[model samples]
Target: MSEGPLDDLDRRIVHSLQQNARKTSASEIAEQAGVSASTVRNRIQNLEAAGILTGYRPEVNYEAASYQLQTLIVCTAPVPEREVLAKKALEVPGVVAVREIMTGTENVHVEAIGSDGDDLSRIGRDLDEIGLEVVDEDLIRNEYECAFHGFDVKDV
Candidate 1:
Protein backbone atom coordinates (compact mmCIF):
# COMPACT_ATOMS: atom_id res chain seq x y z
CA MET A 1 0.00 0.00 0.00
CA SER A 2 1.12 3.58 -0.61
CA GLU A 3 2.25 5.73 2.31
CA GLY A 4 -0.68 8.05 1.88
CA PRO A 5 -3.54 9.17 4.11
CA LEU A 6 -4.99 6.37 6.18
CA ASP A 7 -8.13 4.84 4.73
CA ASP A 8 -11.03 3.64 6.85
CA LEU A 9 -9.54 0.25 7.63
CA ASP A 10 -6.13 1.71 8.38
CA ARG A 11 -7.64 4.32 10.67
CA ARG A 12 -9.65 1.64 12.45
CA ILE A 13 -6.51 -0.37 13.02
CA VAL A 14 -4.68 2.61 14.42
CA HIS A 15 -7.61 3.54 16.61
CA SER A 16 -7.89 0.03 18.00
CA LEU A 17 -4.18 -0.09 18.79
CA GLN A 18 -4.43 3.29 20.42
CA GLN A 19 -7.16 1.98 22.69
CA ASN A 20 -5.01 -0.83 24.09
CA ALA A 21 -1.94 -1.68 22.10
CA ARG A 22 -0.28 -3.78 24.82
CA LYS A 23 -3.15 -6.01 25.85
CA THR A 24 -5.03 -5.99 22.55
CA SER A 25 -3.95 -8.33 19.80
CA ALA A 26 -4.14 -7.67 16.08
CA SER A 27 -6.79 -10.37 15.77
CA GLU A 28 -8.79 -8.87 18.60
CA ILE A 29 -8.71 -5.39 17.12
CA ALA A 30 -9.69 -6.84 13.81
CA GLU A 31 -12.76 -8.42 15.35
CA GLN A 32 -13.77 -5.23 17.12
CA ALA A 33 -12.92 -2.88 14.27
CA GLY A 34 -14.58 -5.17 11.74
CA VAL A 35 -11.54 -6.14 9.68
CA SER A 36 -9.52 -9.31 9.12
CA ALA A 37 -6.71 -10.07 11.56
CA SER A 38 -4.12 -10.20 8.80
CA THR A 39 -5.32 -6.88 7.49
CA VAL A 40 -5.02 -5.36 10.94
CA ARG A 41 -1.50 -6.68 11.40
CA ASN A 42 -0.33 -5.56 7.99
CA ARG A 43 -1.87 -2.11 8.34
CA ILE A 44 -0.32 -1.62 11.78
CA GLN A 45 3.11 -2.56 10.42
CA ASN A 46 2.67 -0.13 7.58
CA LEU A 47 1.63 2.67 9.92
CA GLU A 48 4.62 2.02 12.14
CA ALA A 49 6.96 2.00 9.17
CA ALA A 50 5.41 5.29 8.00
CA GLY A 51 6.08 6.80 11.44
CA ILE A 52 2.38 7.34 12.06
CA LEU A 53 2.30 4.55 14.60
CA THR A 54 5.27 5.22 16.84
CA GLY A 55 6.62 2.99 19.56
CA TYR A 56 4.48 1.94 22.47
CA ARG A 57 5.16 3.13 26.01
CA PRO A 58 3.71 2.33 29.39
CA GLU A 59 2.01 5.16 31.21
CA VAL A 60 3.74 5.17 34.56
CA ASN A 61 2.54 6.89 37.71
CA TYR A 62 5.22 9.54 38.25
CA GLU A 63 4.00 10.26 41.81
CA ALA A 64 4.80 6.72 42.91
CA ALA A 65 8.29 7.15 41.53
CA SER A 66 8.93 10.12 43.89
CA TYR A 67 7.94 12.68 41.30
CA GLN A 68 5.29 14.24 43.53
CA LEU A 69 4.98 17.58 41.85
CA GLN A 70 3.41 17.95 38.42
CA THR A 71 2.74 21.15 36.58
CA LEU A 72 1.43 22.56 33.31
CA ILE A 73 3.19 25.61 31.96
CA VAL A 74 1.64 27.56 29.11
CA CYS A 75 3.50 30.29 27.33
CA THR A 76 2.79 32.91 24.68
CA ALA A 77 5.50 33.59 22.12
CA PRO A 78 6.29 33.81 18.44
CA VAL A 79 5.28 30.68 16.53
CA PRO A 80 8.76 30.39 15.01
CA GLU A 81 10.40 30.42 18.44
CA ARG A 82 8.00 27.96 20.09
CA GLU A 83 9.87 24.89 18.93
CA VAL A 84 13.21 26.18 20.19
CA LEU A 85 11.69 27.26 23.47
CA ALA A 86 10.08 23.85 23.83
CA LYS A 87 13.45 22.18 23.26
CA LYS A 88 15.02 24.39 25.89
CA ALA A 89 12.20 23.49 28.28
CA LEU A 90 13.28 19.86 27.97
CA GLU A 91 16.69 20.85 29.42
CA VAL A 92 14.85 22.14 32.47
CA PRO A 93 15.36 19.87 35.47
CA GLY A 94 12.03 18.03 35.47
CA VAL A 95 10.31 18.68 32.18
CA VAL A 96 8.93 15.57 30.54
CA ALA A 97 7.12 16.75 27.43
CA VAL A 98 6.90 20.01 25.58
CA ARG A 99 3.84 20.41 23.34
CA GLU A 100 3.19 23.12 20.85
CA ILE A 101 -0.47 24.09 21.19
CA MET A 102 -2.81 26.45 19.44
CA THR A 103 -4.75 28.70 21.73
CA GLY A 104 -5.90 32.26 21.77
CA THR A 105 -3.22 33.17 24.30
CA GLU A 106 -0.48 30.57 24.14
CA ASN A 107 1.54 28.68 21.61
CA VAL A 108 3.64 26.37 23.76
CA HIS A 109 2.70 24.03 26.61
CA VAL A 110 5.04 22.12 28.88
CA GLU A 111 4.59 19.27 31.30
CA ALA A 112 7.06 19.15 34.16
CA ILE A 113 7.55 16.55 36.81
CA GLY A 114 9.31 17.39 40.06
CA SER A 115 10.44 15.55 43.16
CA ASP A 116 8.83 18.00 45.55
CA GLY A 117 7.71 21.56 46.06
CA ASP A 118 11.27 22.88 46.03
CA ASP A 119 11.99 20.95 42.85
CA LEU A 120 8.86 22.36 41.25
CA SER A 121 9.92 25.88 42.17
CA ARG A 122 13.28 25.38 40.51
CA ILE A 123 11.64 23.96 37.43
CA GLY A 124 9.40 26.98 37.20
CA ARG A 125 12.40 29.26 37.37
CA ASP A 126 14.33 27.28 34.80
CA LEU A 127 11.34 27.41 32.47
CA ASP A 128 10.98 31.14 33.07
CA GLU A 129 14.53 31.71 31.87
CA ILE A 130 13.41 30.52 28.44
CA GLY A 131 12.04 34.07 27.95
CA LEU A 132 8.40 33.44 26.93
CA GLU A 133 5.72 35.08 29.00
CA VAL A 134 4.31 32.51 31.37
CA VAL A 135 0.64 32.99 30.67
CA ASP A 136 -0.36 30.41 33.20
CA GLU A 137 1.20 27.90 35.57
CA ASP A 138 -1.19 25.21 36.74
CA LEU A 139 -0.12 22.87 39.52
CA ILE A 140 -1.34 19.42 38.70
CA ARG A 141 -2.82 17.75 41.75
CA ASN A 142 -3.93 14.47 40.23
CA GLU A 143 -4.14 13.27 36.70
CA TYR A 144 -7.79 12.48 36.11
CA GLU A 145 -7.07 10.87 32.77
CA CYS A 146 -4.37 10.40 30.18
CA ALA A 147 -4.49 9.28 26.57
CA PHE A 148 -2.22 8.99 23.57
CA HIS A 149 -3.65 9.41 20.08
CA GLY A 150 -7.41 9.34 20.50
CA PHE A 151 -9.32 9.55 17.23
CA ASP A 152 -12.82 8.56 16.22
CA VAL A 153 -13.04 5.57 13.91
CA LYS A 154 -16.06 7.20 12.33
CA ASP A 155 -13.89 10.13 11.33
CA VAL A 156 -11.71 7.82 9.30
Candidate 2:
Protein backbone atom coordinates (compact mmCIF):
# COMPACT_ATOMS: atom_id res chain seq x y z
CA MET A 1 0.00 0.00 0.00
CA SER A 2 1.32 3.37 -0.96
CA GLU A 3 1.07 6.33 1.42
CA GLY A 4 -0.56 8.47 -1.29
CA PRO A 5 -3.94 8.10 -2.98
CA LEU A 6 -4.68 5.49 -5.61
CA ASP A 7 -3.01 6.17 -8.93
CA ASP A 8 -4.67 5.70 -12.33
CA LEU A 9 -3.63 2.04 -12.51
CA ASP A 10 -5.07 1.27 -9.09
CA ARG A 11 -8.38 2.94 -9.98
CA ARG A 12 -8.58 1.02 -13.24
CA ILE A 13 -7.95 -2.31 -11.53
CA VAL A 14 -10.59 -1.61 -8.86
CA HIS A 15 -13.13 -0.49 -11.47
CA SER A 16 -12.66 -3.67 -13.49
CA LEU A 17 -13.02 -5.93 -10.44
CA GLN A 18 -16.14 -4.06 -9.29
CA GLN A 19 -17.82 -4.73 -12.64
CA ASN A 20 -17.30 -8.51 -12.35
CA ALA A 21 -14.84 -10.23 -10.13
CA ARG A 22 -15.98 -13.78 -10.83
CA LYS A 23 -15.64 -13.74 -14.62
CA THR A 24 -12.76 -11.29 -15.10
CA SER A 25 -9.20 -12.57 -15.14
CA ALA A 26 -6.00 -10.80 -14.18
CA SER A 27 -4.71 -11.02 -17.76
CA GLU A 28 -7.88 -9.45 -19.12
CA ILE A 29 -7.82 -6.62 -16.58
CA ALA A 30 -4.11 -6.06 -17.27
CA GLU A 31 -4.79 -5.61 -20.99
CA GLN A 32 -7.61 -3.14 -20.36
CA ALA A 33 -5.49 -1.20 -17.88
CA GLY A 34 -2.44 -1.23 -20.23
CA VAL A 35 -0.25 -3.12 -17.76
CA SER A 36 1.22 -6.62 -17.44
CA ALA A 37 -0.76 -9.45 -15.87
CA SER A 38 1.80 -9.70 -13.08
CA THR A 39 1.41 -6.00 -12.37
CA VAL A 40 -2.34 -6.41 -12.11
CA ARG A 41 -1.94 -9.35 -9.70
CA ASN A 42 0.53 -7.42 -7.57
CA ARG A 43 -1.77 -4.41 -7.49
CA ILE A 44 -4.71 -6.52 -6.40
CA GLN A 45 -2.66 -8.01 -3.57
CA ASN A 46 -1.55 -4.57 -2.43
CA LEU A 47 -5.13 -3.29 -2.54
CA GLU A 48 -6.31 -6.19 -0.38
CA ALA A 49 -3.48 -5.68 2.08
CA ALA A 50 -4.41 -2.00 2.42
CA GLY A 51 -8.09 -2.94 3.03
CA ILE A 52 -9.16 -1.02 -0.08
CA LEU A 53 -10.37 -4.27 -1.66
CA THR A 54 -12.29 -5.86 1.17
CA GLY A 55 -14.23 -8.72 -0.33
CA TYR A 56 -15.83 -10.33 -3.36
CA ARG A 57 -19.39 -11.57 -2.98
CA PRO A 58 -21.73 -13.54 -5.20
CA GLU A 59 -25.16 -12.19 -6.16
CA VAL A 60 -27.70 -14.73 -4.96
CA ASN A 61 -31.28 -15.21 -6.08
CA TYR A 62 -33.11 -16.16 -2.93
CA GLU A 63 -36.32 -17.02 -4.76
CA ALA A 64 -34.54 -19.30 -7.18
CA ALA A 65 -32.78 -20.93 -4.24
CA SER A 66 -36.17 -21.80 -2.71
CA TYR A 67 -36.08 -19.11 -0.06
CA GLN A 68 -39.51 -17.83 -1.09
CA LEU A 69 -39.45 -14.76 1.09
CA GLN A 70 -36.87 -12.01 1.09
CA THR A 71 -37.59 -9.42 3.74
CA LEU A 72 -36.25 -6.06 4.87
CA ILE A 73 -36.89 -5.69 8.60
CA VAL A 74 -36.54 -2.12 9.70
CA CYS A 75 -35.85 -1.65 13.41
CA THR A 76 -35.08 1.04 15.93
CA ALA A 77 -32.57 0.67 18.72
CA PRO A 78 -31.39 3.00 21.43
CA VAL A 79 -28.80 5.31 19.87
CA PRO A 80 -26.08 4.18 22.26
CA GLU A 81 -26.86 0.48 21.70
CA ARG A 82 -27.44 0.64 17.94
CA GLU A 83 -24.15 -0.95 16.92
CA VAL A 84 -24.30 -3.72 19.49
CA LEU A 85 -27.89 -4.60 18.70
CA ALA A 86 -27.18 -4.58 15.00
CA LYS A 87 -24.43 -7.17 15.51
CA LYS A 88 -26.68 -9.29 17.67
CA ALA A 89 -29.41 -9.24 15.02
CA LEU A 90 -27.05 -10.93 12.59
CA GLU A 91 -26.80 -13.95 14.88
CA VAL A 92 -30.52 -14.66 14.57
CA PRO A 93 -31.48 -17.45 12.18
CA GLY A 94 -32.60 -16.30 8.71
CA VAL A 95 -30.83 -12.99 9.20
CA VAL A 96 -28.59 -12.32 6.21
CA ALA A 97 -27.54 -8.72 6.66
CA VAL A 98 -27.82 -5.92 9.22
CA ARG A 99 -27.09 -2.25 8.70
CA GLU A 100 -26.81 0.36 11.43
CA ILE A 101 -27.90 3.74 10.18
CA MET A 102 -26.71 6.92 11.86
CA THR A 103 -30.15 8.22 12.83
CA GLY A 104 -32.40 8.57 15.85
CA THR A 105 -35.26 6.34 14.73
CA GLU A 106 -35.32 3.39 12.36
CA ASN A 107 -31.58 3.16 12.82
CA VAL A 108 -31.15 -0.57 12.18
CA HIS A 109 -32.11 -2.14 8.87
CA VAL A 110 -31.99 -5.93 8.67
CA GLU A 111 -32.20 -8.11 5.57
CA ALA A 112 -33.44 -11.61 6.13
CA ILE A 113 -34.40 -14.58 3.98
CA GLY A 114 -36.89 -17.22 4.97
CA SER A 115 -38.75 -20.16 3.49
CA ASP A 116 -42.15 -18.79 4.54
CA GLY A 117 -44.01 -16.27 6.64
CA ASP A 118 -43.59 -18.36 9.78
CA ASP A 119 -39.83 -18.30 9.44
CA LEU A 120 -39.87 -14.54 9.09
CA SER A 121 -42.06 -14.21 12.17
CA ARG A 122 -39.57 -16.24 14.17
CA ILE A 123 -36.71 -14.02 13.02
CA GLY A 124 -38.65 -10.89 13.94
CA ARG A 125 -39.37 -12.26 17.40
CA ASP A 126 -35.71 -13.10 17.86
CA LEU A 127 -34.72 -9.57 16.87
CA ASP A 128 -37.23 -8.15 19.36
CA GLU A 129 -35.79 -10.30 22.12
CA ILE A 130 -32.37 -8.83 21.32
CA GLY A 131 -33.73 -5.35 22.20
CA LEU A 132 -34.51 -4.08 18.70
CA GLU A 133 -37.98 -2.67 18.15
CA VAL A 134 -39.29 -4.06 14.90
CA VAL A 135 -40.69 -0.99 13.20
CA ASP A 136 -41.56 -2.39 9.76
CA GLU A 137 -41.08 -5.36 7.48
CA ASP A 138 -41.23 -5.20 3.69
CA LEU A 139 -40.80 -7.84 1.01
CA ILE A 140 -37.74 -7.25 -1.12
CA ARG A 141 -38.37 -7.56 -4.83
CA ASN A 142 -35.06 -6.74 -6.48
CA GLU A 143 -31.65 -5.17 -6.11
CA TYR A 144 -29.20 -3.54 -8.53
CA GLU A 145 -25.56 -2.52 -8.43
CA CYS A 146 -22.91 -0.76 -10.52
CA ALA A 147 -19.25 0.13 -10.26
CA PHE A 148 -18.35 3.55 -8.94
CA HIS A 149 -17.89 5.95 -11.85
CA GLY A 150 -15.15 7.79 -9.98
CA PHE A 151 -12.94 4.78 -10.67
CA ASP A 152 -13.45 5.00 -14.43
CA VAL A 153 -10.22 5.78 -16.23
CA LYS A 154 -10.15 8.89 -18.37
CA ASP A 155 -8.86 8.52 -21.92
CA VAL A 156 -5.50 10.27 -22.11
Candidate 3:
Protein backbone atom coordinates (compact mmCIF):
# COMPACT_ATOMS: atom_id res chain seq x y z
CA MET A 1 0.00 0.00 0.00
CA SER A 2 1.81 3.03 -1.25
CA GLU A 3 0.91 6.36 0.32
CA GLY A 4 0.56 9.63 -1.47
CA PRO A 5 3.40 12.15 -1.45
CA LEU A 6 3.19 12.30 2.34
CA ASP A 7 6.27 13.89 3.78
CA ASP A 8 7.40 13.55 7.40
CA LEU A 9 5.03 16.40 8.31
CA ASP A 10 2.06 14.52 6.89
CA ARG A 11 3.07 11.38 8.74
CA ARG A 12 3.28 13.31 11.98
CA ILE A 13 -0.15 14.82 11.44
CA VAL A 14 -1.62 11.39 10.77
CA HIS A 15 0.06 9.83 13.78
CA SER A 16 -1.11 12.61 16.08
CA LEU A 17 -4.69 12.33 14.86
CA GLN A 18 -4.62 8.56 15.22
CA GLN A 19 -3.71 8.97 18.87
CA ASN A 20 -6.61 11.31 19.62
CA ALA A 21 -9.00 11.91 16.76
CA ARG A 22 -11.55 14.19 18.45
CA LYS A 23 -9.40 16.24 20.81
CA THR A 24 -6.69 17.00 18.24
CA SER A 25 -7.66 20.05 16.18
CA ALA A 26 -6.34 20.89 12.73
CA SER A 27 -4.68 24.00 14.18
CA GLU A 28 -2.91 21.87 16.75
CA ILE A 29 -1.92 19.38 14.11
CA ALA A 30 -0.61 22.14 11.88
CA GLU A 31 1.39 23.61 14.74
CA GLN A 32 2.88 20.20 15.49
CA ALA A 33 3.61 19.57 11.81
CA GLY A 34 4.83 23.17 11.32
CA VAL A 35 2.17 23.82 8.67
CA SER A 36 -0.90 26.00 8.40
CA ALA A 37 -4.23 24.86 9.83
CA SER A 38 -5.79 25.01 6.36
CA THR A 39 -2.98 22.87 5.06
CA VAL A 40 -3.70 20.32 7.72
CA ARG A 41 -7.39 20.33 6.89
CA ASN A 42 -6.71 19.99 3.18
CA ARG A 43 -4.34 17.11 3.72
CA ILE A 44 -6.87 15.36 5.95
CA GLN A 45 -9.61 15.78 3.37
CA ASN A 46 -7.32 14.50 0.67
CA LEU A 47 -6.42 11.48 2.72
CA GLU A 48 -10.11 10.76 3.30
CA ALA A 49 -10.96 11.16 -0.39
CA ALA A 50 -8.13 8.84 -1.32
CA GLY A 51 -9.57 6.26 1.05
CA ILE A 52 -6.52 6.57 3.28
CA LEU A 53 -8.66 7.84 6.15
CA THR A 54 -11.59 5.51 6.46
CA GLY A 55 -13.49 6.73 9.53
CA TYR A 56 -13.40 8.58 12.81
CA ARG A 57 -15.03 6.82 15.74
CA PRO A 58 -15.35 7.83 19.36
CA GLU A 59 -13.53 5.82 21.99
CA VAL A 60 -15.81 4.38 24.62
CA ASN A 61 -15.51 2.91 28.10
CA TYR A 62 -17.41 -0.32 27.61
CA GLU A 63 -17.38 -1.00 31.32
CA ALA A 64 -19.90 1.81 31.81
CA ALA A 65 -22.33 -0.13 29.67
CA SER A 66 -21.66 -3.31 31.63
CA TYR A 67 -19.88 -4.91 28.71
CA GLN A 68 -18.14 -7.40 30.94
CA LEU A 69 -17.50 -10.54 28.95
CA GLN A 70 -14.90 -10.56 26.20
CA THR A 71 -13.69 -13.51 24.16
CA LEU A 72 -11.54 -14.25 21.14
CA ILE A 73 -13.03 -16.90 18.86
CA VAL A 74 -11.28 -18.56 15.93
CA CYS A 75 -13.61 -19.56 13.10
CA THR A 76 -12.76 -22.19 10.48
CA ALA A 77 -14.55 -22.77 7.22
CA PRO A 78 -14.10 -23.90 3.62
CA VAL A 79 -12.45 -21.39 1.31
CA PRO A 80 -15.50 -20.95 -0.86
CA GLU A 81 -17.73 -20.11 2.08
CA ARG A 82 -15.44 -17.51 3.61
CA GLU A 83 -17.61 -14.51 2.86
CA VAL A 84 -20.79 -16.32 3.83
CA LEU A 85 -19.34 -17.41 7.13
CA ALA A 86 -18.09 -13.96 7.90
CA LYS A 87 -21.51 -12.46 7.23
CA LYS A 88 -23.10 -14.99 9.51
CA ALA A 89 -20.60 -14.24 12.23
CA LEU A 90 -21.58 -10.59 12.02
CA GLU A 91 -25.17 -11.56 12.76
CA VAL A 92 -24.09 -13.36 15.92
CA PRO A 93 -25.12 -11.35 18.98
CA GLY A 94 -22.29 -9.99 21.17
CA VAL A 95 -19.61 -10.50 18.49
CA VAL A 96 -17.54 -7.32 18.44
CA ALA A 97 -14.94 -7.86 15.75
CA VAL A 98 -14.00 -10.50 13.18
CA ARG A 99 -10.93 -10.77 10.99
CA GLU A 100 -9.86 -13.09 8.20
CA ILE A 101 -6.42 -14.32 9.13
CA MET A 102 -3.59 -15.72 7.00
CA THR A 103 -3.55 -19.04 8.83
CA GLY A 104 -4.58 -22.05 6.76
CA THR A 105 -6.96 -23.46 9.34
CA GLU A 106 -9.17 -20.73 10.78
CA ASN A 107 -10.40 -18.29 8.20
CA VAL A 108 -11.61 -15.67 10.69
CA HIS A 109 -11.23 -14.56 14.30
CA VAL A 110 -14.14 -13.09 16.23
CA GLU A 111 -13.98 -10.87 19.28
CA ALA A 112 -17.18 -10.98 21.27
CA ILE A 113 -18.29 -8.72 24.11
CA GLY A 114 -21.17 -9.70 26.32
CA SER A 115 -22.72 -9.06 29.71
CA ASP A 116 -22.19 -12.44 31.33
CA GLY A 117 -21.25 -16.10 30.84
CA ASP A 118 -24.65 -16.96 29.40
CA ASP A 119 -24.36 -14.22 26.78
CA LEU A 120 -21.00 -15.54 25.63
CA SER A 121 -22.36 -19.05 25.48
CA ARG A 122 -25.26 -17.86 23.34
CA ILE A 123 -22.87 -16.20 20.87
CA GLY A 124 -20.83 -19.42 20.66
CA ARG A 125 -23.88 -21.50 19.93
CA ASP A 126 -25.04 -19.00 17.27
CA LEU A 127 -21.67 -19.20 15.55
CA ASP A 128 -21.87 -22.98 15.54
CA GLU A 129 -25.35 -22.94 14.07
CA ILE A 130 -23.98 -20.99 11.07
CA GLY A 131 -21.39 -23.70 10.42
CA LEU A 132 -18.47 -21.67 11.74
CA GLU A 133 -16.07 -24.13 13.31
CA VAL A 134 -14.95 -22.64 16.62
CA VAL A 135 -11.30 -23.47 17.06
CA ASP A 136 -10.64 -21.54 20.27
CA GLU A 137 -12.21 -19.25 22.89
CA ASP A 138 -10.03 -17.12 25.13
CA LEU A 139 -12.17 -15.26 27.63
CA ILE A 140 -11.03 -11.91 28.89
CA ARG A 141 -11.58 -11.74 32.64
CA ASN A 142 -11.88 -7.98 33.27
CA GLU A 143 -13.46 -6.15 30.37
CA TYR A 144 -14.20 -2.93 32.33
CA GLU A 145 -10.64 -2.84 33.59
CA CYS A 146 -9.67 -2.77 29.89
CA ALA A 147 -9.34 0.51 28.04
CA PHE A 148 -11.43 0.26 24.89
CA HIS A 149 -10.57 1.97 21.62
CA GLY A 150 -11.55 1.75 17.97
CA PHE A 151 -9.36 1.79 14.87
CA ASP A 152 -9.62 3.45 11.47
CA VAL A 153 -8.70 0.61 9.12
CA LYS A 154 -6.98 2.43 6.29
CA ASP A 155 -6.89 0.66 2.97
CA VAL A 156 -3.51 -0.98 3.29
Q: What is the lDDT of residue 48 in candidate 1?
A: 89
Which digits, one per residue and each the tens of the lDDT, describe model 1 over residues 55-156? 988877888898877889887767777778878888887888888876565888888887877887787777778866778888888765433344446544
lDDT of 3 at 69: 68
- lDDT tens digits, residue span 27-128, model 3: 997876568999999988887887767888876556677887678988898888877788779988788778877669888899898888898888989999
TM-score of 1: 0.78
When 1 and 3 are scored with TM-score, the better candidate is 3
Superior candidate under lDDT, 1 versus 2: 2
Residue 67, candidate 2: Cα error in Å is 0.5
List lDDT for all candidates, in order.
0.77, 0.92, 0.76
Clashes of each: 0, 0, 0
Number of the top-ranking candidate, with TM-score as the measure: 2
In candidate 3, residue 83 scores what lDDT?
A: 76
Error of 2 at 114 (Å): 0.6
Tell me, by lDDT, which candidate is best: 2
Ranking of all candidate structures by their lDDT, best first: 2, 1, 3
Q: What pairs collide in candidate 3?
A: none
Better-scoring candidate (lDDT), 1 or 3: 1
